[model samples]
Target: MERTLSVLAAYIQPSPYGAEGVSLNHGLHFTGGEPFLNVDLLLKGIELARKFGIPSLFVETNAFWCRDDDDTRSTMRQLKDAGLQGMLVSVNPFILETVPFERTFRAIQIGSEIFDQKLMVYQTDYFMQFSRLGITDRLPLQEYVSRVGLEEATSRIELLPIGRTAYTLGEWYQHYPATTFFRGTCRAELQRNYHNHWDNYGNILPGFCAGIALGNVLEQPRIYEEGLDLEVYPILRILLDTGVRGLCAYAQKRFGYQEREAGYISQCHLCLDIRTHIVRQAQEFRELRPVEFYTQLGRDVPADQD
Candidate 1:
Protein backbone atom coordinates (compact mmCIF):
# COMPACT_ATOMS: atom_id res chain seq x y z
CA MET A 1 0.00 0.00 0.00
CA GLU A 2 2.83 2.36 0.82
CA ARG A 3 4.42 1.61 -2.54
CA THR A 4 1.08 2.23 -4.22
CA LEU A 5 0.71 5.52 -2.38
CA SER A 6 4.18 6.56 -3.42
CA VAL A 7 3.39 5.54 -6.99
CA LEU A 8 0.21 7.58 -6.87
CA ALA A 9 2.07 10.59 -5.54
CA ALA A 10 4.50 10.30 -8.43
CA TYR A 11 1.68 9.86 -10.98
CA ILE A 12 0.00 13.28 -10.68
CA GLN A 13 1.61 16.61 -11.52
CA PRO A 14 1.97 19.46 -8.98
CA SER A 15 0.59 16.81 -6.59
CA PRO A 16 -3.06 16.42 -5.52
CA TYR A 17 -2.69 16.03 -1.74
CA GLY A 18 -0.51 15.84 1.38
CA ALA A 19 1.79 18.39 3.07
CA GLU A 20 3.75 18.71 -0.14
CA GLY A 21 4.30 21.99 -1.97
CA VAL A 22 1.26 21.91 -4.33
CA SER A 23 -1.83 22.28 -2.07
CA LEU A 24 -2.77 22.01 1.59
CA ASN A 25 -6.12 23.77 2.10
CA HIS A 26 -8.00 20.47 2.23
CA GLY A 27 -7.73 17.64 4.83
CA LEU A 28 -7.44 13.85 4.73
CA HIS A 29 -9.39 11.02 6.40
CA PHE A 30 -8.03 7.62 7.53
CA THR A 31 -10.33 4.64 8.02
CA GLY A 32 -9.86 0.93 7.69
CA GLY A 33 -9.87 -2.58 9.28
CA GLU A 34 -11.14 -0.79 12.36
CA PRO A 35 -8.70 2.06 13.02
CA PHE A 36 -8.62 1.16 16.69
CA LEU A 37 -7.62 -2.34 15.71
CA ASN A 38 -4.24 -0.84 15.06
CA VAL A 39 -4.16 1.90 17.67
CA ASP A 40 -0.41 2.35 17.63
CA LEU A 41 -0.28 2.63 13.87
CA LEU A 42 -3.41 4.78 13.89
CA LEU A 43 -1.86 7.10 16.47
CA LYS A 44 1.37 7.18 14.53
CA GLY A 45 -0.49 8.12 11.39
CA ILE A 46 -2.44 10.76 13.32
CA GLU A 47 0.77 12.17 14.71
CA LEU A 48 2.33 12.30 11.27
CA ALA A 49 -0.79 13.99 9.87
CA ARG A 50 -0.70 16.45 12.75
CA LYS A 51 2.90 17.20 11.85
CA PHE A 52 1.71 17.92 8.32
CA GLY A 53 -0.61 20.46 10.01
CA ILE A 54 -3.69 18.77 8.64
CA PRO A 55 -6.63 20.78 9.98
CA SER A 56 -8.62 17.69 10.94
CA LEU A 57 -8.33 13.88 11.19
CA PHE A 58 -11.57 12.12 10.37
CA VAL A 59 -11.57 8.55 11.73
CA GLU A 60 -14.59 6.51 10.62
CA THR A 61 -14.91 3.45 12.84
CA ASN A 62 -17.37 0.98 14.26
CA ALA A 63 -17.62 1.99 17.91
CA PHE A 64 -18.71 -1.53 18.83
CA TRP A 65 -15.37 -2.83 17.63
CA CYS A 66 -13.68 -0.38 19.97
CA ARG A 67 -15.35 -1.46 23.20
CA ASP A 68 -12.24 -3.40 24.13
CA ASP A 69 -9.87 -0.99 22.45
CA ASP A 70 -8.61 0.52 25.66
CA ASP A 71 -5.08 1.24 24.49
CA THR A 72 -6.24 2.77 21.21
CA ARG A 73 -9.00 4.64 23.00
CA SER A 74 -6.41 6.07 25.35
CA THR A 75 -4.23 6.93 22.40
CA MET A 76 -7.17 8.67 20.70
CA ARG A 77 -7.83 10.54 23.92
CA GLN A 78 -4.24 11.68 23.86
CA LEU A 79 -4.57 12.85 20.28
CA LYS A 80 -7.59 14.83 21.44
CA ASP A 81 -5.46 16.24 24.21
CA ALA A 82 -2.91 17.06 21.52
CA GLY A 83 -5.71 18.90 19.62
CA LEU A 84 -6.49 16.44 16.82
CA GLN A 85 -10.13 16.98 15.83
CA GLY A 86 -12.98 14.82 14.45
CA MET A 87 -13.99 11.23 15.17
CA LEU A 88 -16.91 9.95 13.08
CA VAL A 89 -18.53 6.79 14.48
CA SER A 90 -20.47 4.38 12.28
CA VAL A 91 -23.48 3.73 14.51
CA ASN A 92 -26.76 2.32 13.28
CA PRO A 93 -29.78 0.59 14.85
CA PHE A 94 -28.58 -2.75 13.51
CA ILE A 95 -25.41 -2.36 15.62
CA LEU A 96 -27.12 -3.99 18.56
CA GLU A 97 -28.61 -6.53 16.20
CA THR A 98 -25.16 -8.11 16.07
CA VAL A 99 -22.96 -6.77 18.85
CA PRO A 100 -23.93 -5.74 22.35
CA PHE A 101 -25.21 -2.16 22.31
CA GLU A 102 -23.89 -1.47 25.79
CA ARG A 103 -20.37 -2.48 24.79
CA THR A 104 -20.15 -0.46 21.60
CA PHE A 105 -22.03 2.50 23.04
CA ARG A 106 -19.52 2.56 25.87
CA ALA A 107 -16.60 3.32 23.55
CA ILE A 108 -18.81 5.69 21.59
CA GLN A 109 -19.70 7.46 24.81
CA ILE A 110 -16.06 7.94 25.62
CA GLY A 111 -15.30 8.92 22.03
CA SER A 112 -18.26 11.29 22.00
CA GLU A 113 -17.15 12.96 25.18
CA ILE A 114 -13.69 13.45 23.74
CA PHE A 115 -14.59 14.49 20.20
CA ASP A 116 -17.11 17.25 19.42
CA GLN A 117 -19.23 17.81 16.31
CA LYS A 118 -16.45 15.59 15.01
CA LEU A 119 -18.51 12.71 16.35
CA MET A 120 -21.30 11.49 14.04
CA VAL A 121 -23.43 8.36 13.79
CA TYR A 122 -24.45 6.34 10.73
CA GLN A 123 -28.10 5.55 11.44
CA THR A 124 -29.12 4.83 7.86
CA ASP A 125 -28.31 2.25 5.18
CA TYR A 126 -26.93 -1.16 6.06
CA PHE A 127 -25.92 0.46 9.32
CA MET A 128 -29.63 0.52 10.21
CA GLN A 129 -32.70 1.38 8.16
CA PHE A 130 -32.95 1.77 4.37
CA SER A 131 -32.83 -0.91 1.70
CA ARG A 132 -31.39 -1.60 -1.78
CA LEU A 133 -31.00 1.07 -4.45
CA GLY A 134 -33.09 1.02 -7.66
CA ILE A 135 -30.73 -0.66 -10.13
CA THR A 136 -33.30 -1.45 -12.82
CA ASP A 137 -34.16 2.25 -12.99
CA ARG A 138 -31.64 4.77 -11.69
CA LEU A 139 -29.86 7.96 -12.52
CA PRO A 140 -26.68 7.96 -14.59
CA LEU A 141 -23.59 7.38 -12.41
CA GLN A 142 -22.40 10.98 -12.63
CA GLU A 143 -25.92 12.31 -12.09
CA TYR A 144 -26.52 9.96 -9.17
CA VAL A 145 -23.24 10.99 -7.55
CA SER A 146 -24.55 14.54 -7.77
CA ARG A 147 -27.78 13.63 -6.01
CA VAL A 148 -26.66 11.55 -2.95
CA GLY A 149 -26.24 14.86 -1.12
CA LEU A 150 -29.90 15.54 -0.39
CA GLU A 151 -31.25 14.94 3.14
CA GLU A 152 -34.23 13.17 1.58
CA ALA A 153 -32.13 11.23 -0.93
CA THR A 154 -30.11 9.60 1.84
CA SER A 155 -32.61 6.74 2.17
CA ARG A 156 -32.62 5.92 -1.53
CA ILE A 157 -28.98 4.67 -1.82
CA GLU A 158 -29.54 0.97 -1.28
CA LEU A 159 -25.82 0.05 -1.58
CA LEU A 160 -24.54 -3.51 -1.84
CA PRO A 161 -20.88 -4.38 -2.28
CA ILE A 162 -19.33 -3.52 -5.66
CA GLY A 163 -18.68 -6.68 -7.82
CA ARG A 164 -19.95 -9.71 -5.95
CA THR A 165 -19.87 -8.62 -2.33
CA ALA A 166 -23.42 -8.86 -0.97
CA TYR A 167 -24.63 -6.18 1.46
CA THR A 168 -26.81 -7.95 3.98
CA LEU A 169 -26.98 -7.21 7.70
CA GLY A 170 -26.75 -10.95 8.21
CA GLU A 171 -23.09 -10.77 7.14
CA TRP A 172 -21.49 -9.23 10.21
CA TYR A 173 -17.90 -9.25 8.94
CA GLN A 174 -18.16 -6.99 5.90
CA HIS A 175 -18.73 -3.32 6.73
CA TYR A 176 -17.91 -1.27 3.61
CA PRO A 177 -16.36 -2.77 0.47
CA ALA A 178 -14.03 -1.60 -2.33
CA THR A 179 -16.53 -2.66 -5.01
CA THR A 180 -18.96 -0.23 -3.42
CA PHE A 181 -16.37 2.48 -3.97
CA PHE A 182 -15.85 1.46 -7.60
CA ARG A 183 -19.29 3.07 -8.07
CA GLY A 184 -17.51 6.41 -7.97
CA THR A 185 -14.61 5.18 -10.11
CA CYS A 186 -15.60 6.98 -13.30
CA ARG A 187 -15.39 10.33 -11.56
CA ALA A 188 -11.80 10.78 -12.81
CA GLU A 189 -10.52 9.54 -9.49
CA LEU A 190 -10.17 5.92 -10.61
CA GLN A 191 -10.64 5.46 -14.38
CA ARG A 192 -11.69 7.23 -17.56
CA ASN A 193 -14.51 4.78 -18.19
CA TYR A 194 -15.76 1.42 -17.01
CA HIS A 195 -13.81 -0.18 -19.85
CA ASN A 196 -10.51 1.33 -18.73
CA HIS A 197 -11.13 0.29 -15.12
CA TRP A 198 -10.78 -3.37 -15.98
CA ASP A 199 -8.02 -5.35 -14.17
CA ASN A 200 -7.29 -5.58 -10.46
CA TYR A 201 -3.99 -6.58 -8.67
CA GLY A 202 -3.16 -8.58 -11.79
CA ASN A 203 -6.46 -10.01 -13.00
CA ILE A 204 -8.41 -8.60 -15.97
CA LEU A 205 -11.94 -7.53 -15.02
CA PRO A 206 -14.69 -9.04 -17.21
CA GLY A 207 -17.36 -6.35 -17.10
CA PHE A 208 -19.25 -4.04 -14.79
CA CYS A 209 -19.59 -5.63 -11.37
CA ALA A 210 -23.14 -5.92 -10.01
CA GLY A 211 -24.13 -2.44 -8.83
CA ILE A 212 -20.62 -1.53 -9.93
CA ALA A 213 -19.91 1.80 -11.65
CA LEU A 214 -16.35 1.69 -12.99
CA GLY A 215 -13.81 4.36 -14.03
CA ASN A 216 -11.40 6.72 -12.33
CA VAL A 217 -12.33 9.70 -10.13
CA LEU A 218 -12.32 11.92 -13.20
CA GLU A 219 -12.32 10.55 -16.75
CA GLN A 220 -10.14 12.87 -18.82
CA PRO A 221 -7.94 15.77 -17.79
CA ARG A 222 -10.34 17.72 -15.54
CA ILE A 223 -8.33 20.94 -15.17
CA TYR A 224 -10.07 22.96 -17.90
CA GLU A 225 -13.48 21.86 -16.78
CA GLU A 226 -12.66 22.66 -13.16
CA GLY A 227 -11.23 26.09 -14.10
CA LEU A 228 -14.35 27.00 -16.09
CA ASP A 229 -16.65 25.79 -13.33
CA LEU A 230 -14.64 27.71 -10.75
CA GLU A 231 -15.04 30.92 -12.73
CA VAL A 232 -18.83 30.55 -12.79
CA TYR A 233 -19.38 29.38 -9.20
CA PRO A 234 -16.40 30.32 -7.08
CA ILE A 235 -17.63 29.23 -3.67
CA LEU A 236 -18.78 25.73 -4.53
CA ARG A 237 -16.24 25.10 -7.23
CA ILE A 238 -13.41 26.18 -5.00
CA LEU A 239 -14.40 23.48 -2.55
CA LEU A 240 -14.97 20.91 -5.25
CA ASP A 241 -11.52 21.45 -6.65
CA THR A 242 -9.61 22.21 -3.48
CA GLY A 243 -11.19 19.78 -1.04
CA VAL A 244 -9.70 16.80 -2.86
CA ARG A 245 -6.59 18.53 -4.11
CA GLY A 246 -3.90 16.59 -2.28
CA LEU A 247 -5.78 13.37 -1.72
CA CYS A 248 -4.97 10.03 -3.23
CA ALA A 249 -7.80 7.57 -3.97
CA TYR A 250 -10.73 7.15 -1.57
CA ALA A 251 -11.54 3.43 -1.40
CA GLN A 252 -13.58 1.35 1.04
CA LYS A 253 -12.58 -2.35 1.13
CA ARG A 254 -15.12 -4.46 3.04
CA PHE A 255 -13.89 -7.94 2.15
CA GLY A 256 -10.52 -9.38 3.03
CA TYR A 257 -7.91 -10.58 0.50
CA GLN A 258 -10.72 -11.43 -1.90
CA GLU A 259 -11.68 -7.71 -2.15
CA ARG A 260 -15.42 -7.73 -1.54
CA GLU A 261 -17.86 -4.99 -2.48
CA ALA A 262 -18.29 -2.34 0.22
CA GLY A 263 -20.81 0.42 0.87
CA TYR A 264 -20.65 4.24 1.19
CA ILE A 265 -17.22 4.95 -0.33
CA SER A 266 -17.29 8.74 -0.06
CA GLN A 267 -19.21 8.93 3.22
CA CYS A 268 -21.43 11.47 1.49
CA HIS A 269 -24.19 10.12 3.74
CA LEU A 270 -22.23 11.63 6.63
CA CYS A 271 -23.50 15.17 6.07
CA LEU A 272 -26.16 16.42 3.64
CA ASP A 273 -28.25 18.76 5.76
CA ILE A 274 -27.24 21.78 3.64
CA ARG A 275 -28.90 22.39 0.26
CA THR A 276 -27.51 22.59 -3.28
CA HIS A 277 -28.28 21.19 -6.75
CA ILE A 278 -24.96 19.37 -6.54
CA VAL A 279 -25.37 18.83 -2.83
CA ARG A 280 -24.06 15.29 -2.94
CA GLN A 281 -21.45 15.95 -5.56
CA ALA A 282 -19.07 14.73 -2.84
CA GLN A 283 -16.07 15.97 -4.82
CA GLU A 284 -16.38 18.97 -2.47
CA PHE A 285 -18.83 18.84 0.48
CA ARG A 286 -18.61 19.23 4.27
CA GLU A 287 -19.32 15.56 4.83
CA LEU A 288 -16.38 14.98 2.55
CA ARG A 289 -14.32 18.01 3.55
CA PRO A 290 -15.53 19.13 6.96
CA VAL A 291 -13.71 22.31 7.97
CA GLU A 292 -15.05 22.30 11.51
CA PHE A 293 -16.12 19.37 13.71
CA TYR A 294 -17.44 18.50 17.18
CA THR A 295 -18.78 15.22 18.64
CA GLN A 296 -21.19 15.15 21.54
CA LEU A 297 -23.62 12.66 23.07
CA GLY A 298 -26.59 11.41 21.12
CA ARG A 299 -30.02 12.53 22.34
CA ASP A 300 -30.35 9.93 25.12
CA VAL A 301 -26.74 9.10 25.93
CA PRO A 302 -26.17 7.43 29.27
CA ALA A 303 -24.30 9.09 32.10
CA ASP A 304 -20.69 8.15 32.86
CA GLN A 305 -19.53 6.31 35.91
CA ASP A 306 -19.49 8.06 39.31
Candidate 2:
Protein backbone atom coordinates (compact mmCIF):
# COMPACT_ATOMS: atom_id res chain seq x y z
CA MET A 1 0.00 0.00 0.00
CA GLU A 2 2.88 2.36 0.79
CA ARG A 3 4.50 1.62 -2.55
CA THR A 4 1.23 2.27 -4.31
CA LEU A 5 0.77 5.56 -2.45
CA SER A 6 4.36 6.57 -3.22
CA VAL A 7 3.84 5.87 -6.90
CA LEU A 8 0.64 7.92 -6.92
CA ALA A 9 2.33 10.71 -5.01
CA ALA A 10 5.23 10.64 -7.41
CA TYR A 11 2.94 10.69 -10.41
CA ILE A 12 1.25 13.90 -9.24
CA GLN A 13 4.28 15.73 -7.82
CA PRO A 14 6.10 16.06 -11.14
CA SER A 15 3.10 16.66 -13.32
CA PRO A 16 2.58 20.21 -14.55
CA TYR A 17 -0.61 20.47 -12.51
CA GLY A 18 0.48 18.48 -9.45
CA ALA A 19 2.00 19.74 -6.23
CA GLU A 20 5.71 19.87 -6.98
CA GLY A 21 8.39 19.94 -4.26
CA VAL A 22 5.83 18.75 -1.69
CA SER A 23 6.31 15.25 -0.27
CA LEU A 24 5.14 13.18 2.65
CA ASN A 25 7.63 15.17 4.74
CA HIS A 26 4.85 17.66 5.43
CA GLY A 27 2.91 15.25 7.75
CA LEU A 28 0.32 12.47 7.77
CA HIS A 29 -2.44 11.70 10.23
CA PHE A 30 -4.07 8.28 10.69
CA THR A 31 -7.70 8.69 11.83
CA GLY A 32 -11.01 6.87 11.48
CA GLY A 33 -13.48 4.62 13.35
CA GLU A 34 -10.53 3.79 15.58
CA PRO A 35 -6.98 3.57 14.25
CA PHE A 36 -5.82 1.29 17.09
CA LEU A 37 -8.34 -1.35 16.09
CA ASN A 38 -6.02 -2.44 13.26
CA VAL A 39 -2.72 -2.24 15.10
CA ASP A 40 -0.73 -4.16 12.51
CA LEU A 41 -1.91 -2.05 9.59
CA LEU A 42 -1.39 1.11 11.59
CA LEU A 43 2.19 0.09 12.48
CA LYS A 44 2.98 -1.00 8.93
CA GLY A 45 1.61 2.24 7.54
CA ILE A 46 3.71 4.26 9.96
CA GLU A 47 6.81 2.19 9.12
CA LEU A 48 6.20 2.72 5.43
CA ALA A 49 5.75 6.45 6.00
CA ARG A 50 9.09 6.59 7.79
CA LYS A 51 10.74 4.57 5.02
CA PHE A 52 9.42 7.07 2.46
CA GLY A 53 11.15 9.83 4.47
CA ILE A 54 7.92 11.22 5.88
CA PRO A 55 8.73 13.58 8.72
CA SER A 56 5.78 13.03 11.09
CA LEU A 57 3.04 10.40 11.55
CA PHE A 58 0.15 10.77 13.99
CA VAL A 59 -2.75 8.59 15.04
CA GLU A 60 -6.20 9.44 16.46
CA THR A 61 -8.32 6.95 18.33
CA ASN A 62 -11.23 6.66 20.75
CA ALA A 63 -9.06 4.43 23.01
CA PHE A 64 -11.71 1.74 23.12
CA TRP A 65 -9.11 -1.03 23.27
CA CYS A 66 -7.33 0.33 26.34
CA ARG A 67 -8.99 -2.17 28.69
CA ASP A 68 -5.69 -3.74 29.81
CA ASP A 69 -2.91 -1.51 31.07
CA ASP A 70 -0.12 -3.94 30.11
CA ASP A 71 -1.54 -4.38 26.61
CA THR A 72 -2.01 -0.64 26.19
CA ARG A 73 1.58 -0.04 27.30
CA SER A 74 2.85 -2.66 24.88
CA THR A 75 0.91 -1.16 21.98
CA MET A 76 2.10 2.35 22.76
CA ARG A 77 5.69 1.08 23.00
CA GLN A 78 5.41 -0.59 19.62
CA LEU A 79 3.85 2.48 18.02
CA LYS A 80 6.52 4.77 19.44
CA ASP A 81 9.21 2.45 18.17
CA ALA A 82 7.63 2.41 14.70
CA GLY A 83 8.04 6.22 14.36
CA LEU A 84 4.57 7.16 15.52
CA GLN A 85 5.27 10.81 16.33
CA GLY A 86 2.09 11.56 18.28
CA MET A 87 -1.20 10.11 19.55
CA LEU A 88 -4.60 11.72 20.18
CA VAL A 89 -7.11 10.03 22.47
CA SER A 90 -10.75 11.10 22.18
CA VAL A 91 -12.46 11.50 25.60
CA ASN A 92 -16.08 12.69 25.86
CA PRO A 93 -19.51 11.66 27.04
CA PHE A 94 -20.34 9.92 23.75
CA ILE A 95 -17.39 7.53 23.95
CA LEU A 96 -17.63 7.19 27.73
CA GLU A 97 -20.94 5.36 27.31
CA THR A 98 -19.55 2.09 25.91
CA VAL A 99 -15.90 2.36 26.98
CA PRO A 100 -15.53 3.19 30.64
CA PHE A 101 -13.63 6.34 31.55
CA GLU A 102 -11.23 4.16 33.57
CA ARG A 103 -10.06 2.41 30.40
CA THR A 104 -9.62 5.71 28.58
CA PHE A 105 -7.80 7.13 31.58
CA ARG A 106 -5.43 4.15 31.61
CA ALA A 107 -4.74 4.65 27.89
CA ILE A 108 -3.95 8.30 28.52
CA GLN A 109 -1.61 7.41 31.35
CA ILE A 110 0.24 4.79 29.35
CA GLY A 111 0.28 6.90 26.19
CA SER A 112 1.69 9.87 28.09
CA GLU A 113 4.42 7.74 29.62
CA ILE A 114 5.38 6.27 26.23
CA PHE A 115 4.75 9.15 23.86
CA ASP A 116 5.64 11.80 26.42
CA GLN A 117 4.54 15.26 25.32
CA LYS A 118 3.27 13.77 22.06
CA LEU A 119 0.10 12.46 23.73
CA MET A 120 -2.96 14.72 23.71
CA VAL A 121 -6.72 14.44 24.15
CA TYR A 122 -9.25 15.57 21.54
CA GLN A 123 -12.66 16.57 22.96
CA THR A 124 -15.88 18.24 21.84
CA ASP A 125 -18.24 20.39 23.90
CA TYR A 126 -21.38 18.51 22.87
CA PHE A 127 -22.04 16.04 25.65
CA MET A 128 -25.45 14.35 25.76
CA GLN A 129 -27.26 13.50 28.99
CA PHE A 130 -26.85 9.76 29.36
CA SER A 131 -29.16 9.09 32.27
CA ARG A 132 -28.30 5.40 32.41
CA LEU A 133 -24.62 6.11 33.12
CA GLY A 134 -25.39 9.09 35.39
CA ILE A 135 -23.21 11.33 33.17
CA THR A 136 -24.87 14.72 33.58
CA ASP A 137 -22.25 17.48 33.59
CA ARG A 138 -20.64 16.61 30.27
CA LEU A 139 -17.15 15.11 30.49
CA PRO A 140 -15.25 17.61 32.59
CA LEU A 141 -12.10 17.62 30.48
CA GLN A 142 -9.98 19.81 32.72
CA GLU A 143 -11.14 18.00 35.85
CA TYR A 144 -10.49 14.64 34.22
CA VAL A 145 -7.00 15.72 33.14
CA SER A 146 -6.24 17.02 36.63
CA ARG A 147 -7.35 13.71 38.06
CA VAL A 148 -5.11 11.82 35.61
CA GLY A 149 -2.13 14.08 36.46
CA LEU A 150 -1.90 15.28 32.84
CA GLU A 151 -3.63 18.62 32.81
CA GLU A 152 -1.59 19.94 29.91
CA ALA A 153 -2.73 17.32 27.38
CA THR A 154 -6.32 18.38 26.88
CA SER A 155 -7.67 20.42 23.93
CA ARG A 156 -11.34 21.29 23.65
CA ILE A 157 -13.05 22.21 20.38
CA GLU A 158 -16.49 23.41 19.29
CA LEU A 159 -18.93 20.99 17.74
CA LEU A 160 -19.48 21.56 14.03
CA PRO A 161 -23.08 21.70 12.75
CA ILE A 162 -22.66 19.15 10.01
CA GLY A 163 -23.69 15.60 9.09
CA ARG A 164 -26.12 13.94 11.51
CA THR A 165 -25.53 16.62 14.11
CA ALA A 166 -27.18 19.24 11.87
CA TYR A 167 -30.45 17.37 12.25
CA THR A 168 -30.15 15.61 15.60
CA LEU A 169 -28.09 17.65 18.06
CA GLY A 170 -28.54 20.96 16.27
CA GLU A 171 -31.42 22.18 18.41
CA TRP A 172 -29.20 22.13 21.47
CA TYR A 173 -27.48 25.33 20.36
CA GLN A 174 -28.78 28.73 19.28
CA HIS A 175 -28.35 29.71 15.64
CA TYR A 176 -27.56 33.05 14.06
CA PRO A 177 -30.34 34.98 12.34
CA ALA A 178 -30.64 34.35 8.60
CA THR A 179 -29.66 37.97 7.94
CA THR A 180 -26.24 37.33 9.47
CA PHE A 181 -25.13 35.04 6.65
CA PHE A 182 -21.86 35.81 4.82
CA ARG A 183 -20.52 37.55 7.91
CA GLY A 184 -18.05 34.70 8.49
CA THR A 185 -15.32 33.04 6.50
CA CYS A 186 -14.14 29.48 6.15
CA ARG A 187 -10.90 29.52 8.15
CA ALA A 188 -9.91 26.05 6.99
CA GLU A 189 -9.90 26.91 3.29
CA LEU A 190 -8.34 30.33 3.72
CA GLN A 191 -5.60 29.06 6.00
CA ARG A 192 -4.72 26.22 3.56
CA ASN A 193 -3.22 24.29 6.43
CA TYR A 194 -1.11 21.19 5.93
CA HIS A 195 -3.33 19.02 8.08
CA ASN A 196 -5.72 17.19 5.71
CA HIS A 197 -8.13 14.34 6.35
CA TRP A 198 -8.27 11.06 4.38
CA ASP A 199 -10.96 8.44 4.88
CA ASN A 200 -10.57 4.66 4.48
CA TYR A 201 -11.35 4.98 0.75
CA GLY A 202 -8.65 7.70 0.39
CA ASN A 203 -10.98 10.67 -0.20
CA ILE A 204 -9.07 13.83 0.81
CA LEU A 205 -11.29 16.53 2.30
CA PRO A 206 -10.44 20.12 3.12
CA GLY A 207 -11.67 19.74 6.71
CA PHE A 208 -13.82 17.43 8.81
CA CYS A 209 -16.93 19.63 8.62
CA ALA A 210 -16.42 20.87 5.08
CA GLY A 211 -17.52 17.90 2.98
CA ILE A 212 -15.95 19.39 -0.15
CA ALA A 213 -13.58 16.81 -1.64
CA LEU A 214 -10.19 17.78 -3.08
CA GLY A 215 -10.04 14.46 -4.84
CA ASN A 216 -8.90 11.04 -3.70
CA VAL A 217 -5.19 10.62 -2.88
CA LEU A 218 -5.20 7.05 -4.25
CA GLU A 219 -6.23 8.48 -7.61
CA GLN A 220 -4.89 11.40 -9.67
CA PRO A 221 -4.44 14.71 -7.88
CA ARG A 222 -6.90 17.44 -8.88
CA ILE A 223 -6.15 20.22 -6.40
CA TYR A 224 -2.61 19.13 -5.52
CA GLU A 225 -0.68 21.85 -7.34
CA GLU A 226 -3.08 24.72 -8.02
CA GLY A 227 -5.22 24.10 -4.92
CA LEU A 228 -9.04 24.02 -4.90
CA ASP A 229 -10.70 25.97 -7.70
CA LEU A 230 -13.45 27.89 -5.97
CA GLU A 231 -14.77 29.15 -9.31
CA VAL A 232 -15.06 25.64 -10.71
CA TYR A 233 -17.00 24.59 -7.64
CA PRO A 234 -19.87 27.07 -7.84
CA ILE A 235 -21.41 26.12 -4.49
CA LEU A 236 -18.17 26.52 -2.57
CA ARG A 237 -17.27 29.74 -4.37
CA ILE A 238 -20.61 31.30 -3.51
CA LEU A 239 -20.33 30.13 0.07
CA LEU A 240 -16.87 31.60 0.35
CA ASP A 241 -17.81 34.86 -1.31
CA THR A 242 -21.34 35.55 -0.02
CA GLY A 243 -21.66 32.99 2.74
CA VAL A 244 -24.79 30.89 3.24
CA ARG A 245 -27.06 33.79 2.25
CA GLY A 246 -25.47 33.92 -1.18
CA LEU A 247 -25.99 30.22 -1.71
CA CYS A 248 -29.56 30.48 -0.51
CA ALA A 249 -30.18 33.26 -3.02
CA TYR A 250 -28.52 31.27 -5.81
CA ALA A 251 -30.63 28.22 -5.00
CA GLN A 252 -33.84 30.26 -4.96
CA LYS A 253 -33.07 31.92 -8.29
CA ARG A 254 -31.63 28.89 -10.06
CA PHE A 255 -33.74 26.06 -8.67
CA GLY A 256 -36.59 27.75 -6.82
CA TYR A 257 -35.34 26.47 -3.45
CA GLN A 258 -37.28 27.32 -0.32
CA GLU A 259 -36.12 28.11 3.21
CA ARG A 260 -37.46 26.61 6.40
CA GLU A 261 -39.48 28.82 8.78
CA ALA A 262 -37.28 27.96 11.77
CA GLY A 263 -34.19 29.56 10.16
CA TYR A 264 -30.74 27.86 10.40
CA ILE A 265 -28.46 26.98 13.27
CA SER A 266 -25.39 28.18 11.35
CA GLN A 267 -23.83 28.65 7.93
CA CYS A 268 -23.31 24.91 7.70
CA HIS A 269 -27.03 24.28 8.15
CA LEU A 270 -27.95 26.68 5.36
CA CYS A 271 -25.22 25.31 3.11
CA LEU A 272 -26.35 21.75 3.68
CA ASP A 273 -29.96 22.71 2.92
CA ILE A 274 -28.99 24.30 -0.41
CA ARG A 275 -26.77 21.38 -1.36
CA THR A 276 -29.49 18.93 -0.43
CA HIS A 277 -31.97 20.79 -2.63
CA ILE A 278 -29.60 20.92 -5.60
CA VAL A 279 -28.77 17.24 -5.19
CA ARG A 280 -32.40 16.28 -5.25
CA GLN A 281 -33.33 18.57 -8.12
CA ALA A 282 -30.60 17.76 -10.64
CA GLN A 283 -27.84 15.25 -11.24
CA GLU A 284 -25.49 18.01 -12.48
CA PHE A 285 -24.70 18.89 -8.89
CA ARG A 286 -22.55 15.72 -8.73
CA GLU A 287 -19.72 18.00 -9.86
CA LEU A 288 -19.57 18.98 -6.22
CA ARG A 289 -18.13 15.49 -5.63
CA PRO A 290 -18.86 13.24 -2.66
CA VAL A 291 -22.58 13.52 -3.42
CA GLU A 292 -23.33 10.95 -0.76
CA PHE A 293 -22.20 13.40 1.92
CA TYR A 294 -24.90 15.96 1.10
CA THR A 295 -27.52 13.27 0.45
CA GLN A 296 -26.97 11.60 3.82
CA LEU A 297 -27.73 14.66 5.95
CA GLY A 298 -30.99 13.02 7.20
CA ARG A 299 -33.18 15.13 4.87
CA ASP A 300 -34.52 13.50 1.76
CA VAL A 301 -34.57 15.14 -1.65
CA PRO A 302 -38.14 15.84 -2.74
CA ALA A 303 -39.43 13.65 -5.57
CA ASP A 304 -40.98 16.52 -7.54
CA GLN A 305 -39.19 19.63 -8.74
CA ASP A 306 -40.98 22.94 -9.32
User: What TM-score, computed on C-alpha atoms, does each candidate reach?
Assistant: 0.38, 0.72
Candidate 1 structure quality by residue, lDDT tens digits, 1-306:
232222223223321333332221124445543676676766776666555455434566766455456754775688676545666666443333444544545555676777744565554343332224322221343343344443343344443323112222213233443233333222342223222211112121112321122211232223223323334433334224432221112211211112212332232221111111122222343222212111111111111111
Root-mean-square deviation of each candidate, in angstroms?
18.7, 7.7
What's the TM for model 2? 0.72
Model 2 poorest 10 in a row by lDDT: 12-21
Task: Say which candidate scores most in lDDT.
Answer: 2
lDDT by residue (tens digit), candidate 2, 1-306 = 674446334322221222212222245667776877789999898888667755446688888888788888988888888888777777664576567666766777898898776676665232211233454333554444444343222234445666556666555556665566667655455346545565555566666544565556656444466556556567667656766778778989998887766666777776766777777677564235566666665363333232
lDDT of each: 0.37, 0.61
Q: How far is candidate 2 from the true structure (C-alpha RMSD, Å)?
A: 7.7
Lowest summed lDDT window (length 10), candidate 1:
268-277
Q: Clash number for every model?
A: 39, 0
